[model samples]
Target chain A: MKKTLNAYSEQMNQLMGKAICLPHGPFSELHEAMRYSLNAGGKRIRPVLMQLCYEAVGGKEEIESFLMAIEMIHTYSLIHDDLPAMDDDDLRRGKPTNHMVFGEATAILAGDALLTEAFQIMLSDALRHGGLERIRAAHILSEASGMGGMIGGQILDMASENKTIDLATLDCIQLHKTGALIAAATKMGAVLGGGGSKEIAALEAYGKYIGKVFQIVDDILDAISTAEELGKPVHSDEKNEKNTYLSFYSIEESYAIAKALTDKALKLLEQIPGDTSLLAEIAETLIKRKN
Target chain B: MKKTLNAYSEQMNQLMGKAICLPHGPFSELHEAMRYSLNAGGKRIRPVLMQLCYEAVGGKEEIESFLMAIEMIHTYSLIHDDLPAMDDDDLRRGKPTNHMVFGEATAILAGDALLTEAFQIMLSDALRHGGLERIRAAHILSEASGMGGMIGGQILDMASENKTIDLATLDCIQLHKTGALIAAATKMGAVLGGGGSKEIAALEAYGKYIGKVFQIVDDILDAISTAEELGKPVHSDEKNEKNTYLSFYSIEESYAIAKALTDKALKLLEQIPGDTSLLAEIAETLIKRKN
Candidate 1:
C-alpha cells in the first residue's frame, strides 16, 4: 500500500508541477498558490483511489489525465475552504493556505483556476477516449468536487463549524464533504472506463463507505495524533471548535464505527467479483493516512 | 434579438428555480446567495450568446442545460469580485452585493455553489445530448471561465487596480478579464453544433472583439451614466481610480474605437457563411446599451 501510494504521489507531483509551470502570466501568484496547495504533500488518496478503482475494474494505469482532473478539483476545494472567511485557518497541510501565502483575492482566483483546469484537462483526456467517456468523466468529477459533493460538503462544514452536530448530522456532512469526492473518484473511473452501471454503483458504495471510515479515523486522529504526525496542526478541529465525529462520538465509539464502515466497504468491493486487491489495499491504506 | 434574449431569460429563470429548488441541504443559504446573485438581473449575455451561436451554427435550443452553466460561472465571478476582501463593492446590478445580503462566508460558498452548479448543469445537459457534445461543451465553458480565460483576466484586473498600466498590460487584462468567456460562448456554441475550424475561429474572433468592446463600453457607461441609469453605482472607475479606455481616450474617441471593434466583430461573423443576425444585433446592442 505504501509503495502504491508513493507511486501516485510521485506522479501527481509531476502532474501538478506541469500545471504549476503553465504560463498564468501576472496571475502567476494565483498559479503559485494553487501549486503550493497541490504540492503541499498530502497522501494523494483521491488519485490513488481513482487509479485503483480503474485497475480493479479491469482498467489500466493509462488514464492518468483523469486522475489529474479529480485532484485539481480536490485541491481547489482545499484552497477555498482554508480561506480566512471560510475555515479562517492560517495553516493547512503543514503550511500557510493559498490566501495566507498569496493575497486572499489571488487565492480565490487560484482556486478557481485549478477548478476550471480540471474540466479542461478532462476534456483533453476524454477526447482521446472520445464518445461518452469524456462526458462521463466530466459529470463524475463535477459531482464529486462541485456543489452537493465537495463544495456542498464544504458549505455544510462551514455552516456547522463552531456549533455542535449530532451523529446523523456529522455523518451527513462527512459523507458529502469528503466521501462524495472519494466515492466519485472510483465510480468515475469505472464509468469513464466503460464499466457497467452495476459495477459503478458497487464501486461508488465501496468508495463511500471507505471515505466515511477515512474521515472518522481522521476524527480519531485529531483526538490523538500530534501535529508533526498529522502534518497540519493537529488540534485544529478543537481549536476551531468545529463539529466533528469526535465531538459527537467517544474515541472508542468512533473507532468502532470506522472499523465497521471499513469492513462494509471491503465487503462491497468483494462483491465486485474481481481480485480486488487494489481496492482492498486502498481502503486499508486510506484509513491509515497520517496527513 | 429581443425574442431570443427573452426566450433564454425565461428559460433561465425556470431552470435556475428548478436547480435551486432541488434540495442541496442546509446549504440553502449558499444556494440563496447563489440565487441572489444569479437571480439578480443582468443581460444574460453569455448563455444567450452561447445559444445564439449554437443556433446560428445550426445547433438547437436544446442547449438549455448549458444556459445556466455559463450564467453560473459569470454569477460566481461577480459574487467573488464583490467580496469585501476582493473588489469590496457594496453594490452590484443596482442591488446589495451577495456578501452584503448574505454574510461573506455564505456569499463565498454561494459563489462556489454557482461555479460548481455550472458543471453539474453541464453534465446533465451533456448527458441529454450524449457525451461527445457534452465533452465539447464542458471543455469550451471550463476553458473560457478558467485560468487561461476569465480567472486569469480577473487576477490581472486585481493586480492592475489603482495602478498605472501600459497599453500592453491593459490589453492583456481586457482580453482575459472579459474577452475569454465571451469568446468561449460563441466558440463553444459552434463546437457543440459542429462548427468547422474556420467558423470557430471566426466566431472566436468575433467573441474576443465584442468582449473588449463590451468592457470599453462599460467603462464609458461608468464614466457617463448615472447610478439609476446604469443600475449599479456609477463613477466606480473613478472611485476605484482604475484606468480605462475612457480614462485614456475621449468619450467620442472611445465610442469610435468601440464602433470600429464592433465592425470588426460583425465582419468576422459575416465570414462564417451563415445567418449571423443574432450576433450582429448583439454587436449593435452592445454599442446601444445605456448600462
Candidate 2:
C-alpha cells in the first residue's frame, strides 16, 4: 500500500509539473507563482485517492489530466486561503506562502488562473472524449469546489470564527469544506470508471467517512503536533479561535472518533465488491497518520 | 437596435437574478456578495453578444444558463479586480465595490464562488443536454478566462504599472485582458449555435475588433468623463500610469482608430450569411458611446 501510494503521488507530481509549463511571456510571473504553490510538497492525498479509486473500480483510461485538475483546484484554494484578507498566513509547507513569495496581486491572479485552468483541462478532456461521463465528472468536481461545497465550508468556518460552536456546526463546516472534495475524488473516479450507481454511492459513503476521519485527525494533530512536523503553524485553529472537534472533546476522544470513522469507511469498502484492499489500508492509515 | 439590445439586457438581468437564488445558509453572506455583484447593473454586453451570435446562426435552444454563466465570470473578474490589493476601487456601477460592502474576505470568496458557480451552471447545462457542443463552449470560455487570456492580460497590466510601455505591449495587454472574453462570447455562441468553423472564425474575428473598440472607448472615456458619469473614478489609467490608446494618440486619433476597427468588424459581419445587422449596429454604437 505504501509503495502504491508513493507511485501515485510521484506520477501526480510529474503530471502537475508539466501541466503549467507555458512559454515565458508577460504573465510568466503568474505562471511562476502558480507553479511554486502547486509544487509545494504535500502528501498528494486527493489525486492519489482519485487514482486509487479509479483502479479499484477497474478503470483503464488515462486520467492524468483530471488528477492534475483536482490538485490545481486544491492548490488554488490554499493560495487564496493564505491571502492577507483570508487566513493571513505567512508560511505553508514550511516555506513562505504564495502571497509572501509573490506579491498579493500576483498571488490572487495565480489562484484565479489555477481555478480557471482546472476547468480548461477538464473541458478540453471532455471535448476529446466526446462523452457525457467527462461532463458529469466535471459537474461533480465543480459543485464540490463551488459555493455549496468547499467555498461554502470556508464561509461557514469564517462566520463561526471567534465564537464557540456545537459539534453539529463543526460537522457541517468540515463536511462542506473538506468532505465535499474528498467525496468528489472518489465519486469522480467511480463515474469515470463507469461504476454503477450502487458502487458509486458506496464509495462516496466511504469517502465521507474517511473525510471525517481526516479532519478529526487534522484537528488532533493541530492541537498536539509541532510546526516542523506539520509544515504549517501549530494551534492555528486555537489561534483563530475556530471551533473544532477538539473544542468539544479531548484529544484521546478525537482519536477514538477518527478510529471509528475509519472503521466505518473500511466497512463501506468491504461492500464495494472490488479490489478495495488498498482503500481499506488507506483509511486505516489515515486514522493513525502523524502528519 | 437599441430596443433589441435592451431586450437582451433585460432578459439577462431576469435570468441572472434567478440563477443564483440559494436557500439561506451559514454561507448566505457569500451568496449575497455574489448576487450583489451579479445584479450590479451593467449593459450585459458579453451575454447579449453571445445571444446575438447564437441567433445570427439560427440557434433556437434555451441558452439562458450559458448567458448567466458568462455574466457570472465577468462579475467575478470585476469583484477581484476591485479588491484592495488590486485596483482598490471604492465604487462600481454607482455603489460600493464588493469588498467595500461585503468586506475583503467574503469578497474574495464571493469572487471565487462566482467563478466556480459559472462552471457549475455550464456543466449542469451540459449534463442535461449531453452533447460535445456544450463542452466545446465551456472549453472556449475557460480558455478565454484562464491564464492565457483574461488573467494573463491582468498580470501584464499590473506588471506594466507606472512603466512607459510601447503601443504593441499595450495592445497585447488589452487583447488578453479585455479582448479574449469578448472574442469568447461570439465564439462560444457560434459553437453552441452549431455554426461551422468558418462562421465561428468570422464572428471571433468580429469579436476581436469590437473588443478593441470597446477598450479604446473605455480609455477615451476614462480620460475625458467624470466619476459620476462613469459611476467610477475617472483618469484612473493616468493615475496608475498605465498605458492605453490615449497614451499613444490624441482623443480624435483614438476615435478614428476605433472607427476603423468598427468598420473592419462590420465588414466581417457582412461576410457572414445571417442577420448580422444587430452586431454591426452594436459595433458602430460601441465606438461612439459615452458612459
TM-score of each: 0.93, 0.98
lDDT of 2 by residue, A126-216 (tens): 8888888888888999999999999999999999999878888999999999999999999998888888888899888888999999999
True contacts kept of 2: 0.96
lDDT of 1 by residue, A72-150 (tens): 8888888878788877777877787788878888888888888778777777776666667657777877777766777
Q: Show where candidate 2 strays beyond 4 Å.
A: A1-3, B1-3
Over B16-111, each residue of candidate 2 has an lDDT whose tens digit, in order, gives 889779788788899999999999977899999999999888798878778988999999999999998999999998899999999999999999
Second chain TM-score for model 1 = 0.93
Which pairs of residues collide in model 1?
A: B153-B177
* Global Cα lDDT for candidate 2: 0.91
* Candidate 2, position A124, lDDT: 91
Point to the candidate with the largest lDDT: 2
Worst ten in a row by lDDT for model 1 chain A: A1-10
DockQ of each: 0.70, 0.92
What ranges in model 1 sit over 4 Å off? A1-3, A162-164, A273-275, A288-291, B1-18, B23-25, B272-274
Every candidate's lDDT: 0.79, 0.91
